[model samples]
Structure formats: C-alpha cells, structure tokens
Target: MTLSKAFYLLSPRNFALKSKIPLRSFARGYANSEVLRKTPLYDFHVENGAKMVPFAGYSMPLTYGNVGQVASHHHVRTKAGLFDVSHMVQSNFRGKTATEFLEWLTPSSLSSLKPYSSTLSVLLNEDGGIIDDTIITKHAVDAFYVVTNAGCRDGDLAWIKQKLHEWNSGQGKEGPVEHEVLEDWGLVALQGPEAASYLQSLTSFDLRQLTFGTSAFVPIEGGFNVHIARGGYTGEDGFEISIKPLQTVEVTELLTKVPVQLTGLGARDSLRLEAGMCLYGNDLDETTTPVEAGLSWVIGKERKELGGFIGAETVLKQLKEGPKRRRVGLVVEGAPARQGAKIVEPTTKEELGVITSGIPSPTTGKNIAMGYIKNGHHKKGTQVAVEVRKQLRPATLTPLPFVKANYYRG
Candidate 1:
C-alpha cells in the first residue's frame, strides 16, 4: 500500500519495519485508531496467536502467544524462523534508461551488476544526505526490483516518482524509466541455519545454486511460482520469498509447517541489530550520508571517480576528506544504551554523538549499540561513555556485526 493509505489505516500502536524512533513520537504522529492498516497476512497472524501491535500503520505480530523474544531470536540462529515482511514497499523500474536512472539515484555501480544480483544501496537527496536505505536487485538490463523500508514508504516513493518524471522529461534522455509499485505483495523471510535444507524439499530449482545476493523464480509444490532471493536481514543463511498476494498465505503456511518458528518483530529487531544492519529512521535519516554511516563500501570505485549520482559532490568529498563523524559499534559495560543515548568522551564527558540503535545482544550476552562518534574515536578499543538512564556507562568501541554473518556464498 502507498504510505498515505497505510498511515490512514494504521492504529496508535504503530506497526513498522523501522521503529527505532521513540514511542512518544508515534503517539504524537498517529494516535488515532482509524488509521491502522493490516497486511494480507493479518488473518494468518491472528490465527497463529500473534500479539498484535500497531507498527508503521499495520497490525503486525510482535511475538506469538507464549514464545518469548529471546527464544525466537535463538531459534532463528540455531534452526529456522519465518518472518512476515509484507509491509515493506516493493517496486519495479523498467525502461531503456532504467540502469542509468538508478545510477543517477544512488552512488552504486548498477551498470556492472550481473543479472539476478542484488546490492545494498542508499537513495540520497540533492545535498548528499540519505533519503532511505534500499536493496536493489537487477533482474535484467531494463528490469530492476527494489525493496525499501516500510517507514520510508511515503518519502521514498515520492522521491523516486519525481526523479523518474524529471529523468523522462529531460531533453537528452535516451528513454523514460517506468515506475511500478507492487502494493500489498507478500514478502516472507525464512531465516536461520536450516533454511536451505527446508526449502530444498519443496522446490526443484537447485537451492544450492542460489547463493547469497542472488535470486530466481522457482516453482514450488501445488505448481506455485515465486521469486526467491538468497539473503536476509538476519546474520543467518536464509531466503526471502516474494509471492503474489493471493498465494502468500498458502505459501507461508507450507513453509512454516515443520521446523520453522513463527518469529515476530521483537526478534526481528534484535536480529538485524546483531547483524549490524541499520534501520531507516534510527540509524539513517535525511541528514546522514552513507559515508558517515560507514557504508562507503556500497559506492563503486569507478562511480566514485566518475561522480555521476545525486549528491555525488558531497559524498565524493566525504570519501576523499573523510567524514567528521563515523558510525561505530560499541560494547557497553552496564545497562543497554538505547536510541538517543548520548555518546561522550571518557574523562571530560564531551558529547561526541548519540546512539541510534542499541540492544542487549541475545547472541553475545552483552549490551551492544551502534552510534555515530567522532572519526578519531571510532577505532576499535577506544574508550567512551554512553549516557544510559541518566548515568554514564562505560563503553568500548568495537567491530560491527556483533554476531558473525553466515551467508551461503557457495
């Protein structure tokens, strides 16, 4: 659904993919119950004993009946877990200049991307600030599939549509880019160590060949065809299956039949946090640039030199001169530092930045956080203090991805 439709249908609890923003913010923005919306799997969630919560305008599952958040988190790490991510905005861009259009939007090198390959990218504004973080998958020269955060639905769509119009109307444009929003599509993320083995039994498309960052259209039992991508937000080996709205429920039921645990947003948050992934509204905002977020690797080396994309001047400048502040991973000594927690120097308590995301890592048994800190203080082993609960907690800057990622590259 378009963000406006979703927001108006949404309720006070606020169901969304990116909710690192304080709950008070949501209360102020969308407190009315009439605006709450639901995904196609709303009935399925209710039937499965999901604890309904308002998020990003949808009534989403926070956790199933008796299953605790920690259990679900561990289950996904050791076995398999099913996550309903249908609230995310999915779209397709097609046209002769589609590649160029995408290149112009982000700093990534889409021209060199192989078919069926995907890469994490960011949409930037004219000032080189990030509009939203996105996953762009190249299906063909003219066909591209993109998945953006649910919370960014409104802004992302508007920016993309406006850019498409401008690109099409430009005098020297080779061809216009066509934008298609796939509203209410079903996106199921099957994650964990056993994901491949479970999926292999239902599909004959050689799951082994579908390595990380790749995707293919495969036929499953009951003659159902779906688009499956080999990557997930969690640090586990997994697949994200994209199905038509009509077949989503059936496909989800079939996939969750045996070993897959029904996971909810509670676990999803901790999982992505441990995986070192950034949530749009929290770790990323329009004022933040990819370089400052430690996402310089997403920029292509050639693209860096050519400087073609929007906000290239600022991004390139940051790459060359270095960002003033850098996002860093930290291990807190006591009490979990949450969003908005101030990051300060140890002795002087000089504020460097603030924590964008933080949680007690289910895997590491330690309080972990990701935040922006002054460049020199971002190195590992550096000492810092996080203001948690009005007290300064000892923190040490550390490497990101608290848990090692396990993507099936082979």
Candidate 2:
C-alpha cells in the first residue's frame, strides 16, 4: 500500500473507533531497528505509559496509555497538552554578521526583527524550492536560535556548515560566524487554551510579557533556567520550552501534572492538521516552493525588492506572476483524501493536482485536506473532486486553519 493509504488507515480516527488494531503494531511496522535514535526523555515517556514509535529517525511516543488520539487531541484543544518535541534539531548561530548571514539563506527580514522575537521562515534552495520550514528566533543583532525539522537534520546541518565555511572565508565582510548544534536538548511544547495559566503557576516570570512569536529565558519554580518560546504547532495558545539535557526529565515531570496531559505524535498530527499546519515529509518537500505552499508571507517585503536570498529570482518572479499551482485547503465530502490522492476538475475530470495531507477533523466533524491545485481552481468555495478509494468525492476549496487560531498576541 502507498504511504498515504497506510497513514490514513492508521490515523487516529481508525484506531479508537473503527478498528481493533493496536497502535503499537502500526508503529512497529514503521520502525527501522538498525539506526533508531532516542531522545533524552525516552525513559520518561515509557515511565508515563507512552506507546513508543519510530519517527524521523528517532524512537518517539505515539500515544500515552489507553487514551485515544481523538481524546488527546480534544484535551489539547480544550485544556492543555505537553508534547516531547526534543527530536527536533535546535542550533545557535552567533557572530558579528549573524543577521546578514541568515538573511542570505532565508527570505525573512531578520534585520528588522526585534530581539527575542521569532518568525516562521523557510530555508530555500537555489531553485527556490523549500529546503525546510523553520522557526528562527533572533536573540540579538549577532546571535540567533534556530529550530529545524528532525527529519532534515543531516541535510540542513551539512548545508549550513558548507555555507558557514564560504561565508566566513570571504563573503561576509563584518565577521565570521560560529554554529553550535544543541545536541540532545529537551524541547517540550505546552499547548492549548490553559497553557499560559498552567505554565505561569510553575514560572515566576510573567508569561503575559512573552507574547506569541517571542521568546525569553524564564526561571522555573524548581530552579531551572530555560528558554521558553510563546508559540507552537497547534493553533491554540502555547509555549515551546527548551530545557538543559540534565534537567529535561525533571522539567517534563513537573509540566505533565493535572490538566497538563502527555500528548504524542498521533494527537500532534491531528492537531496540526486542524490548525492547517504542514508536516515536513507529507505536506511539504524540497520539490515545493514557499509561495506554492501558501507561505508567501514568510518572504520579507524588503527582501523581495532587493532579491538576495537563495532562489530569489524564482520566488520574486512567482510573487509577481503567481505560481502555476497553489496549495489549498479542502473539505472533502465523503472519505478523507490521503496524500497522493488525485485532485481533478469536478465536471470534466481534468487532472489538477494531488492531496498532500488530510485527516478526519475531530473538531470540525469534516474530512479536511490540504493539497496543490491549479491556481485558478484554488479560490475559496471553488467546487472540486478528490479521488478517494477509486471514487470521486465532492469537495470544496476552503480557507486554512479550519479552526480559528487562539494566539496570545499581546
């Protein structure tokens, strides 16, 4: 079976209600025993009844105990959920020319970014294809903290290292930059409606001051000083906390108390889908551009005119002429359209594009999907058809974030 088909069958909707198939069985099927890595919280997860699974070269938790993924997903939407995102790669870049160095790699306007503020940016290739989607936090004019996808670790680091050498050698006029990889760091995401209040009870630093897309060093009640960023993959209000390797277990133990349940990849996937967030391997890839992926806002306005970042030529051209195809949200009528499912014109059945990510939304009670389609067919409310299980299902193009975002903008 295709990967998308397997994923659709193993999705949360199938596990708790439709099938008696155990989630662990599906997890084991994806495991590669030869090279699986473990995060710092691996033991902590097992102690908390987590069902572990191999993902992105790491053995990560799929779900906790007997709680269904739907329940975990809803709990995060209503209350709060703590996720072990330590598998993601975190790095620190510092030097006199750090901002200039980063601007040359990404399309974001890092020079204009306020200290401690963050932006969702993309690392682009020479042809303007997305290398990876990342969250970049500016610590100072000369320092930056970057988080990238776990799956792209090797490629991203290699690319950055090569560029660093070239920039330090001659390209950068200000000074040479240094790159430090935070290996095995413990990164956890505390997400949902009550995230701030629950986190406030543990930290003396006022979370109110740490608004969305911002970060700060906060002192936890237990004497742990860590970095806390006020944003997450879920559309709800949340914080992504980075902890010291030695303090990871203790900090995680403290956070996973009453009202802060442990969440796993299953719930994380569904939650992100409901939020219209893209998954690296499934929804985004190196073959796709940021503009075509509906991430045009990440390209800085000033950078657009000056055109210095990687793939600037292709990106700027697309920005003006528009892409041939565009990523769009869809509300599938019948079955959920998994990745690789064909998108076609409703009437003539002309091939348009293919589905990249989809799920039965627990919140909306609708089968929602994201995919690329011909540009003219991407407008909201445009009628379309998705091929699912060898049948065409009626669908409509819709706006993203099927559920409204609850960001703490203040």
Candidate 3:
C-alpha cells in the first residue's frame, strides 16, 4: 500500500538494503524487487534501521526507523538533522588553466572567486541548454573542488572525460589537467540554526571563519581531518562534511547521537524546494537555459563579451536580449501544482508555462512551486492560472526562495 507522507513518521525498525548498485550507473532506475544502488554509508544506513527506498538509482533512506517526514523536517528547521549525501559526486581538478577550463564548461567567473569560495554553475550544451548544474569551489589558480548531483553522473562524467581528451590532444596548447574523483568518500550534511553550535564542540578549527559558500579542512574530535563546506541544499545555515570511507560510519554515529536527528529524502525534497533549488530532471536538462532559470548571475561578465565556451554565443545573446521563457517562483492556489502542470493566462486561458519543481512546504505550510513562464509574464506577483486535473486555478508569480535563506557570513 502506498503510504501518505504523514503516516510514516518514525517508521519501523527493520531496515536493510537487499541489493547495492554501483555509483557509475546513476541514470538507471532502481527497484526494491530488482537492483538497488548503494552509497559508501549503505551498511551503516542498514544498521541504523534506515528505510531503504529506490531513488535515482540508489537504495537510500527515505525515512529512518519510524520517524516521519514532517517530524524530521521540523527537527532540521529548529534543531539539527543529519543527511547521508554521499551519493553526490565529488571531484578535484588541478593544473594551470584550471579556471579557464572550468569557465569553458560553465558560465561562472572562477578567476574572481576567493580561495575556498564556491559558486553555483551550469554546464551548458552547444544549444545553450544546461547539461548539468554544479558547484565549483576555488582553492587556488590551479586547484578546484567540484560537486555534481549523482543523478547526472553519467552525462557529466562523459562530458568531462570527452573534453579532457580533446584538450589533451590540443593544437600545441598546454597539457590537459588532471582530475580525481573522491569515489570512496562519504558525505554528511549537518543543517539547522543550531548546526554550528552543535558541530563547534567537535572541532578545534574556528567555525567562525568558515562563511557560507566557503570550505576548509578541519580537524575533528577523533583526529580525522575532514573537508567542511559551509553551505547546504536546505535554506538554513549548515555544513556539508566530506569524510573518508573508513571513518564514515563512525562519524555518522557520533554526529547523530544526541540532539542531532537522522533526516531522510522526504524532508530533503521539501527543504530544497523551499530554498528555490532545482532538481535536475524536473527543472533543468539539455533543453533549458541558465538565463531562464534565474541563474544569469552565474554567467561571467567577461565571458559574455568573449563568447568562446560551448553555447557561449547563444547564452551570451540571450543574456543581452533575454530568453523566450523564464523560470520563476509561483504560489499556487488550491491544490499544489506539480511538475508538468500546465500554466495558462487566468482570464484568456492562453497557455503560458508549466510547473517544474513544487511541494507543499512543511516549513511555511504553503503550496509553493517553481516553473518557466513565457517571457513577458516573468515578473513577480503577476497573476496566472494552472491546470490541476482538468480545471484552471489561480497562481501568483511569486518571488523565488519561498523561504528566506539564513547563511552564515561570519
């Protein structure tokens, strides 16, 4: 029987991963009855009684034990919640022209980035559509740390490897750079208003210096040095810690012991939705431009004029004039508008757009959604209509980030 999201609060204790799929084949779907993918913390998740479910090819915890999605959602907002995000792909690249290489892949200006600082960027296709969205962290002129969603693994890796090969066989250009995938690593996100205070007791490194969008290697209580990044998918102040495989289970146990709760995908979905973050398949793909997704900020000013990267000409032109359709926030009235929901002009019933990512936000108790609207109606507070089931319902062109962000600046 399909259970309502509310019914499984604090679920059953018997949890196990019947199968474990590898990280390389992330695009393939998973089924409980068939093959299932596993993260580095798979064994630990089973031991902790996490309810394993098939998600984006991995057998991940959707909810833990008997704790429901709502309770976990509340815990992360008010206190602290720990998430097993090890399925995400983490890689480090180093060499001269690193910034140039990355700039060719994404529209962001990596050269201007401060050391240890990160920026959200997108890999665009030759047609100006996004191949994948990613986070690029600058350590120095020649070093970078990048993180991409697990769902986009195959496409992203293939693209990068192909580019690397092409760059290596260049016309007497500098040798191609090298990259290492931290494939065996595990990641945990400690998020909430109380996150820093909770994590502060375990590390000697000054958490004060690590602001949002920044990262540093920190020495922890058990003497293990971890890469602590001060940012998260949730809108709250939080950190994403990257740990070695052998230390993962121990670290997860230590962090979730007292005050910290183990949250699952349900809470994560709602939180990211509230934060105005896009899920790859739903909001972005090879057909969508960064400009329409309210991500023009990522396009570097210098890159716009030069236009040498893939889709650079198309993306730059769109930046100068504007995209035909624009992604924007929405407040749906009546039922929650889901992906593929048709958006229409309220009075004339003229088709305008479609919903992309949406959820009934557990934080604010509102039905918030995001979608792409036709060029002219992208402004905030513009009225529109969405077809739910069969009838049209009113929707407001709301400002993004249904909730406000509480990033740690100091």
Candidate 4:
C-alpha cells in the first residue's frame, strides 16, 4: 500500500449525500431554535427511562436515573449490560478493488486481513494529524465494513465522496465500487464478564468459539440475525450487535430479558475512561495522530514501509523518529482532574499537557486521567502535576487502565 497505490484505491466509495442538514444545533435547545438528530432507538430510550442529552448533534441518553453511574459501571464489570449505540455510522464497501480502495483512507493493511477480522485504524489528515479514528473489518478481499464516529459524519462522508468521484473518473482506473450506508440501523453492545454466557443462551451457535476482535452473523429469537462483533469500548468480554432499525426495540427487549441490565452513556463514558479509551471530540480531533496518541500500533508495518494512506509521509517520519509528545496514563492525587485539567511538571510548574479524559474509578477508588505530555515525561512512574481549580495537584504517570482488563480471549 504505497502512496500512489493508496490514492488509487480511495477512488470508489458511496456516501449519503441527500440526508437533511441542520441549520441550527440542539446545544442550545429552544422551541424552533434547533432540534438534534435522533437515533432509531430514540423513542425506545424514552420508554426505558433514559436521561437524554444533546451530544454530537444527536439526542442521546446520558444516564438512567434508576441505575446510578457507579452501579451501572460495576454491573457491566461483573455482568452483561445493554447499550443502544444506534448513533454510530455504519457503511459497507464492495467491489473488485474494495480492499485496495480502503487502504487509501486508513493506514491498516486491509488486503492482508482475514475474513471477519477487524482492526482499529486511523483516518489521518495530510499533515499526519487524525481526522478520525475508525474500525475497519474485512468480510472479503472484495469487501469491507467500516464504522466511524458520528461526530465526523459530515466531514468523513464528504471526503469519501469527493475521493470517489475522483477515483471513478481518474485515468486508467477500474471504475466505481459498490458502497452502501446502513442508515437508520441499530447497534447494541452487550459487555462484561458474563457477556458470553448471556449471549450463548440465545443461540445454538457456541459463542465460546468466537475469539476477541472478530465478528459473525448470529441468530437470536424472533428470527433476527445480527452481525455480532466480538469487541467493545469497555475492556471486557463483549459483543457489539448490529441490527436493523425496525427491530431495535424488540431486539433490545429480548437481549435485556436475561441478566443483562440496561446501561446508559454515563456508565459507558466512565467505563471507557477506565479502559483509557479516547472519546472523539474530547481526546482526539483533526490535530491528533496515531503516533502522538500511542496508537502507532494501529498502523500496519507494511503501511509504514510502503508509505500508503494520507499523511504517510509525516506519520512515517514520526514513526521512524518518535513523536515529541505522547499520550499516556496518569494516576493523580486529590480530586479527579476532568477534561482540560492542565498537567505540569511538579518542581518547575511548567505546563506539560492537559487531561483529555478522567474518572474517579469505582473499581479502583482512585483518580485516573489520560492525556498527552511531552515525550520525556511520559515514562511510567514519572511524577507530574495537574492544575485542578487553579491549584497544583501532585500526580504520577502510571500505567493505563488503573483497573486491569478482564477480556475473555477465547
């Protein structure tokens, strides 16, 4: 996947261009002022007593009053929890050169990925900054499944479409690829230590055989089959089920009919923070890069060598010679340092970084934060200072996920 080859592959993908546009946003809601986009499960969330909030131009559930955030987090840690992730954007790409097409947008070596296997990848800007972080799954050499953040929907779709028109009309090209947007779809995540047991009860398909980071279609009651993906934002054994919008409510009721408790965004945010995962707008935007974010691991080795994908020149240079600043974990003292909390050197009070995400860990009973600091101060155990309420608070750069992951490899 070299630069020229990558540009060659990025030329044919579909985008939903005719969707309605927002003249105003719900961030400041008022009658006729603005309205947010709603997921397919919007009414379902209301029926389940969800505390909805405006997020990423969509009306989404923040938390449920019946289940406190801490309890919900713990429940998901010990047992399965259900979430309506219908806000995420899902799309499909299929053509004789689909694999080659996707390699141009992301740095992962998609051509070599096994069927039904997925890899976390980044969509880099030309300057080596992250445009968006993405997950790409290969169903066949001629096809792929791509999931990107909703926050970047407009920009991502526009970029993909612009690239498509160019790719299709380019000189000596293979022509357009078949692409589909699974719009108005439903996505549900069932995660925890007991997730496998809970999901296994629904089908004769022995889920124990499904390894982590994989996906397959699985049958459930009501004759509904779903693309069950064996991965989640929480660092626990889980499955992300992709379903049709029409069947979301019924499917959710069926899944939660078991021991699984209904969870919301509050618990989801805390769980992800505890896992040291990045939240799109908070932790990353158009300015972050895989290398600077300690995600160089996501870039394929061949991609590094071949200089494929956008921003390859800068990413490769940074990869060859490490980035000046790097994302890392910190175990801070005193109160929790939430987003934008400044990180500084303890002795000199010189600013180092700012907390991108943080939480008072219910499982660990510690204040944990994740952020980027100057490369030299990123080593484990390095003491740092965080500015909380204008006062310097002592903190240390500890290893990530203050609590260890409990993923079931099998």
Where does candidate 1 have its weakest 10-residue lDDT segment?
20-29
- Write the residue-wise lDDT of candidate 2 on 45-126 in tens digits: 8998887666777778877888878899999999999999998999999999999999999999999999999999999999
Q: Model-by-model lDDT, in order?
A: 0.87, 0.88, 0.82, 0.79
Ranking by lDDT: 2, 1, 3, 4
Q: What is the C-alpha lDDT profile of model 3 across 116-227, one tens digit per residue?
A: 9999999888899998899899999899999988777878899988887676567216646887899879999999999899899898888999999999999988878889
lDDT of 1 by residue, 1-410 (tens): 99988754443344332333245323322345547678889999999998777666666787787897788999999999999999889999999989999999999999999999999999999989999999999999999999997777777899988888889999218878899999878999999999999999998889998999999999998889999999999989999999997998999999997789999887898899899998777788889999999999899999989889999999999999998999999999878888899999989989999998888888999999999998888889999999998999999998988999999999
Candidate of highest lDDT: 2
Judged by whole-model lDDT over C-alpha atoms, candidate 1 comes out at 0.87
Query: Relative to the unseen true structure, what is the C-alpha lDDT of residue 145 in candidate 2, on a scale of 0 to 100?
Result: 99
Q: List the candidates' TM-scores in order.
A: 0.93, 0.93, 0.91, 0.90
